[model samples]
Target: MRRLLVLLLALLVATPAAAQVRTGIDVLQQNGFAQLRAVAARHGGKLKLAVLANPISVNREGRRTIDVLRTEGQAAVPGMAVVKLFSGEHGINALTDDMDIDDKVDAASGLAITSLYGRTDAEKRPSAAQLAGLDAVVIDLQDAGVRYWTFQTLTKYFLQACAANGVEVIILDRPNPLGGLAVQGPVSTPGREDYTNAHSEPMRPGMTMGELATMFNAEDRIGAKLTVVRTTGWKRADWYDQTGLLWINPSPNLRSITQATAYAGTALLEGTNVNIKGPGEAPFLRFGAPWIKGTELAAYLNARGIAGVRFLPVTYVPANDKLYPFAGQRVQGVEVLLLDRDRIDAPALGVEAVAALWKLYGATFQIEKVDRLLRNRAVLDQIKAGVDPKRIAAGWQADLNRFKARRARYLLY
Candidate 1:
């Protein structure tokens, strides 16, 4: 009896908890969850309120069909037993507010309200009260593959809520607009983990949501009942256009694939006095300031001959975007012309841009904001101290190698 009991204890210790309940997870392991057929098998029969985050305006294709709780959902998504959604200070639900240049209010009230995290932006996570007794929560949002974007962090919080509440989460995974390579920038340090810097991945991690889900489940150890509905036929190296999906601006400023690619670097510029011209016609594609001479800036950038990019002098007024501090004021800057996608070292370019901006603007440049985006002040310190972009990039190699190795098992494509 004693010998038999000892063997049982050993076996129990070897197996993971809730292993039996997770058997259904592999239902569509080969085909990406973006395939609607598998989801229809389970969620098709019912139609009810859904507690979804973001808004329906996000999914253009889904808008063709149902309209419930402002979720742009297809027929196959399970009925929301209890509908819920969160809108951060950025007002993820609507376009840039024309009058609110300073983000003083949540102008996105046009969207149906479920749970507004507007003024209380810092705290955004579903409570057990909101998540209990739901069949599952379906999430489908496009990400620029950056840590500070908020969507990735939102996913982490939602996953934690669901894990605690015994609710399942179905992620309709989309492609990372920047492609699934070039995982650059620093890992979030021991502290400063929030909705923005949710995970330990670099500022620009090149992984799809499906891949991220695998990492979150294991690395973060949330243990939520998570299932990723991955896109079919998406290769690991494919960008947004390569996937044959229409480029819906994930946010107001990320207008094109080129802009999105450039964003991997220029997004750090958001914290500065300089206008990246993101709110104007071409965001991330161009940046400027009143103090800058467009021609001079262009010449300097062109001189760098940064791989896979070219610079051209440009001038514009950012008045169209009320949120722009330089709105209605004309400014001179350089437009980033993408020459080749694969060859571009985006973050490296970003470092160089920061260096240039710091060199020119001095006290006027809001250098501290770059730390918020990169999640590591060390990166800002090194760049300000005249560190080369390649050498700075080389610093993260050990961490990147370890992350890549650890993430190998999680990648689907």
Candidate 2:
């Protein structure tokens, strides 16, 4: 018994205790939905709320936020009921890959789900009728910490619509899976904001959704009644993997945290006429096209000795023609292997990849389309002029510094 106790003590000492990080939903539950109840009390004694959520919008125990709000929220706080549901880019279930999602009734909850993503830009925001009788719209979303993910864009539009319609907005914050550090890429150019580039922020702005919401509310001058249920037990520098929370893919393609980290850089290639990954393959882990010479491209990137990643030549034949142009044909590319997440400058590495593609296959590569995601005309011009990628990355420092200073005021954690 004495020997067994000694061995058990040694084992416990050797293993590090898991870090505890509770998201906004978890904190809200712990407080028995007091904040939401207050919002309900503001509007007489009852509140009709609409929830904007996805599969990832769950409490620490893996209960969906919508269900929790409907059941526990109503039970704990009388006169508070979830009347409607909203879905973003991937639909409510986070399974749809189509461009437009139609409204439907959730079988389990029997609530109408209005999709924020639609066939056109105008349909992305809530119609005046949709917000007519709502006391508050509760938003719980998981962001990938990149500019082009579209969830943040949807949130921005939602905020604007709520402000216009005199509806309150409540955001249940989650961690930036990539962590709230290492802001990279260039801020979107003026007069170039779109669904992908919703605001003038870097590709990886290093801010959580709640922080972004606070910034957007103030900076954009949308005076909507806004409340952010701030996440607790999360440090500014801690990545999602360290949070002791389950990993639920924010979108269909982002399968792992490494993929989410790589996405900050690799997604820049998405606008270009290149295959970032094939169907059923890991997204953002590889990039290719029919015309690419895998070994040559890999060699060029490898020679640069980019931080936190290594490149390997690969050949793949995409099975789906629905997405990639080179379906049913052999394609070549490089696989990005993340070595040190803390040390990697993903956006810089992305610039290097684009430059390599430009250098080797400029004729076939539609480099100009990169501006859609890159959002920096000057950087695109530099790439077109064959300027060093390092120089291009260096030019972003002034803008990043300015953004960092502005961003510091809004951080909640």
Candidate that scores best on TM-score: 2
Cα displacement (angstroms), candidate 2, residue 269, comes to 1.1
lDDT of each: 0.65, 0.88
* CA RMSD per model (angstroms): 14.1, 2.2
- Residue 138 deviation, candidate 2, in Å? 0.4
lDDT of 2 at 258: 92
Query: How many clashes in each candidate?
Result: 11, 0
Error of 2 at 407 (Å): 0.3
TM-score of each: 0.78, 0.96
| Poorly placed runs, candidate 2 (over 4 Å) | 1-16
